[model samples]
Target: MASFHLEEDEIEKGEETMGSEPEVDEDPSSSSATWGPPHQHGRRRVNNYSGGAVGLNINEAPHVNKDSTPFCVFMLYFARIIRLLVEETNRYYHQYLDELQDGPSPRPDMTDSEMFLFLGIIIQMGHDIRDRLKDYWSTAEQFAMPFYSNTMKRDRFLHILRFLHFADNNTETDRNADSYDRLWKIQTIFNTLNDAYEKYYNPSKHLAIDEIIVKFKGRVVFRQYIPKKHKRFGIKIFKICDATGYTYDMKVYLGKDRTRADQDVTATHATVRGLCRCIEGVGHKLYMDYFFSSPDLFEELMTKDITCCGTVRPNRKGLPDDFRRRQFRLKKGDIRVRVRWNFTALVWKDKRDVYILTNMHCPPAEGSFCDEHGNAIKPAIVADYNKHMGYVNKADRMANSYSISRRTWKWTNKLFFHFLDMTILNSFILLSSCDAKLSHREFHLALVRNMLEHAARGPPRPQRSRGRPPAVSSAISRLEEASRHHWPTSSTSRLRCRVLFV
Candidate 1:
């Protein structure tokens, strides 16, 4: 194994010594951190944002206002959102009336306070899931949850949900037009939240682009089926997140992108580019996996003043012929490197072969790093990837743990609830800056409780029916009111009730 490693390095050294390598097509840039040879353009050589840089310099250190509450922080992102929802929801309700001259309009038009009460219930529902939506309204002692029945009538709550709408029924744009949107049903909500996501907070220098799946099994045209993902079947969203696990931007993947067919870039390249637009032309370090990384993509991004590093597939185009070979084996901690115009393509051996490509760190390929308690570890690039690459995944994991998602066959419901969770999660993240010790669950409970409290104080709550209340069980009836219990006077009775004196 050692001989093989030595022979591989020697062969590469001999080529350089003999000057047998082909010269690059472009002149080297005058930049100080220039690697290998000159490139086509004077692109980024290091990751740093010049205060003089004029683009998206949102190198953010986010903080919540010291005087703010969770509701205030949430409203900061969703105030306009809730208002838009109320307007559209009421519009849709009235539209239904005009269409059917509908029988008694499903429980009066939704109001601002009522809509909030509805949202409060939805948020609370995500905290604890039951068998069915109706279960929340159950009046049985074992299944009773007063928050649901007390805030609003079961029928009224379901009425608002049934007519819940975002886009107007009459305002849908033409499908035949080139600007058609596949997700028009929730497009407004998607864009509104997405904008708020970026507008409120800017990420630090380290950003990662990766795919996130919202678990869905409904029959939708754009639903993705990735067997390897925990959500094996769902909608796929490509998000560029900060090192802090905040989603800075996202692109919902619909089938084949017709928009990219006219462009020279691959779908993955375009996805990464679209997600990175806010951070482009700024010397922010991007990280992704091999599926999104390639020599062309890396260099293209470099030209835009962004430097990225990721694990590369040996078979990817522009990788040297030797890297594409999977036949050979190497001892642990062995490495083979090929440098091309600020990009370093590396093959390091550990439990198995690992390939990496980057225009960032150019670590010595002779030996592995021993940064962990004197034990050998992977190289610098691997260490950095491990540190920053899981931010998106962490965000997903956190959201899923207390997701407000409910069972639904409607694609509209799935998309709406999923993004709703995203909004809550992002709001919680912002609030954390103010109270660093707050947990997501605690923040969520506090936020929902605050909303419910407001709803409780708002106009009179829905009253129970005017008839006799539902019958109580014998056990509950006996324990509540003090009553005289006359036992049958029988000597044959073996069981007796006796009060113990304390």
Candidate 2:
């Protein structure tokens, strides 16, 4: 794709055109009707559907229970996914034992049913594994009764945790090096979940792409430290999410650029492009941050019928020189536009200099808003970018609120918990989309309860604490005698008195 710098004449024409249009107050609900700039005389036509096309049609969309009970929802939407995890886990467990040269031990191997129970307990534990396991084994109370399983002891559960593998060991070495190099142990499971994510639901037209940090402060080659993120050190994942925080696609960022062959393009552009490959030619509008925005990227996405709007860094290449130099000189609410054949860049003065680049929206014919001081106006593209770029942040906040993941030395294990968190988040999104009124906490609690009830026999009765039962008969006799003796004397004295002994 070719990129061009905006000339003086084009800038003048854009300003004159913007100034001549009549200003009309717009309602928030009608924002989608004028999402992008109006079609210009010589620009290529872009699709601006009010509600973007669905990824899957109604007939092809995954069926979710509209009126099922909570338990039924668990069975239909969640049980099978957990079952798959249990099966894969058990297979890997036995394979590890068989490979041991010391031969089979006296302990029996874990069954699929037992693995299911183990996972259910872990989900409800939400604490350090060792501490939680000790409590489950030692506590003698009604609250802990449901999690106790007679078939699986603490040692056995620990064994499963230590050797919990998602993919076959033999085939791990032979796996594709490009995508599965560092994360080979869990790559198969990751791919499986990714497939399910895309197949189950189609997101709306407006999508946001952003990076999420999975907390992992371990000795790993690919660990990242993003100072601005809440978790400063962890694995970074690039995600494409819809307006409702549904993750449509994701790509884990491994250390260096092993997958991409092009060296000239920055990794940010490559990550955005790769995550967007699925929605290409679908006329979906993408909103992003400064890290992933560039004129070249917008130009390339235009070819794929994808329109992008994002804040551009002033230092980024291809921005007009005058806009960069004179940005500080413009008064608040002052707006300037520079247009090429296919690309448009807007420089608006808000609190500071704000640069936005897009191919979808033209210079707004009339849309503008005043600041708090009524001194400056804001462009329509800036408004739209602010509206749609928050989905990824919302998702991150939701996932982190009730994260079940624990601290671990192994990055893969940390990542496994991250996936579990994502699964719960996705399930909440799915349930809410089906018009269910359950909150995130409610959905999770229901799933945990239903899974335990379905997978295990009713909670084992609490074992009574070992001690002699208290002899209450003697105390009862003494209390009765004392009351009888005091009743007569207290009646005549006009004073009420009673005695009890225990």
Candidate 3:
């Protein structure tokens, strides 16, 4: 259909000549038009369309809902997706026995489970449930209801506690230690969510791997230097996002150091290794910045059949002059590469020339691949340019304007700090996948602030000291008594009998 509308110039400029004279080549019985333009060089022919419905469409054009309203299609579609996520999460929680060890008979009201559901729903809806709850319950009198009665919403607080890994046994009132498990859990949840989103994505050959810095608080133990809160930090994430930012696969990494600042070679390598593991066996070309320039890592990845594409760092070590030249000159296992180039230079490597190295062998000429040393070039080719995709650092002229102190973050609750960043990223990915109209970076910037604002809407209720433990019900007492004197009966049956006897 497209070709019929716009053929190549070869077809458009063909040299089909016209005769010098006009003559009727039809029988007298044939219908014909005797029309001619004045002073034409030669006779021309025009075919008249005799098919039906040549002038058909009249009303449908303007009537088709071109209304300037936000389409509810995305809202409905995203709602359905979120609903599925909630149901699946609920099933997973029960299936894995997240509450199994908490007690023998599960509480009719599962506080932890409710919190999980609440958080899941919040994330899925692209809003913070806590903030929404607070907005809905603004007064002390309004909190008298059973759901809102708890001074701190202990269950909800517990959920956040688990999410942040805040331990209950810290000696100092000032001690605010966040747990490792909470951070890991958030990663796990998003990974699972990404997998689920992938099953519905169209299979394209290209995948993009890039990094985006989300502002963070606290000194990351792994990071060498602390970056300003809004300053760039490497967030090594591998995603299979379409041109419109619909992500098929999303893998987020915190970088070599929490700060992802420079001077951490080992951390960078580890980040590459983790990102590479996600890319392995996906049968797509992956892109990276010069920071990913490492020959050993590339070769290791190539051995596993994953091709890489990115600018290679110049100098500092062993790279052959030409990849093609080296292909024949060097042995299979002897190859090693190390990147050493100033990124600020027009061409960072080999006397101010951009360098690219790929197991792909061929890449777009505009993005020619070279070895550490100036080498023979090959035309770049990927199975599909769309599938082997990427977007590098945003042009500096248009970066975000807001700034926050990088140092002040260290004193905050670490898990919430991390959660806040992850939540922004997760929301961006969610909005991108659901709304086919936005780009990855566009979605990241557009909705992230709103999501963070929602997160920062603050508490729905006043903070309080830890409260008294709930009284043990008669059923629990009977269960405890049964534990002391177990009969030759099921624990449930023994407890029931003890309750009646008591």
Ten contiguous residues minimizing lDDT sum, candidate 3: 1-10
lDDT to native, each model? 0.69, 0.64, 0.36
Superior by TM-score: candidate 1 or candidate 3? 1
RMSD of each: 15.5, 18.9, 20.5
Clashing pairs in 1: 28-38
Q: Which stretches of candidate 1 lie above 4 Å from their native place?
A: 1-46, 50-64, 101-106, 325-328, 367-376, 435-437, 456-502
- Writing each residue's lDDT as its tens digit, candidate 1 over 1-502 gives 1211111111121110000112245532433323332223223333457323221223432335544566767776677878788889889877776565214423455667787888888988887789888989998887898878888789888888888888886778887776778888888888888888887775777788877777889898889776544567888788888766678899888777655554666778777777877777657888887768888788778777788888777887677667776654666667666666566777777656788887777544554544345434666666777787777877787777778787777777777887777777887777664445677888888888778766667676444344433234543455454453553455345343333321
Stretches > 4 Å off in candidate 2: 1-63, 68-106, 126-133, 136-156, 174-180, 324-328, 364-376, 457-502
| Model 2 weakest 10-residue run by lDDT | 13-22
Model 3 global lDDT (CA atoms, 0 to 1): 0.36
* lDDT, residue 134, candidate 3: 46
Each candidate structure's count of clashing pairs: 1, 5, 13
TM-score of each: 0.78, 0.72, 0.39
What is the per-residue lDDT of model 2 for residues 458-497, given as tens digits with 9 covering 90 to 100?
Answer: 4342342554333466445655777866534445345433
CA lDDT for candidate 2: 0.64
lDDT of 2 at 73: 40
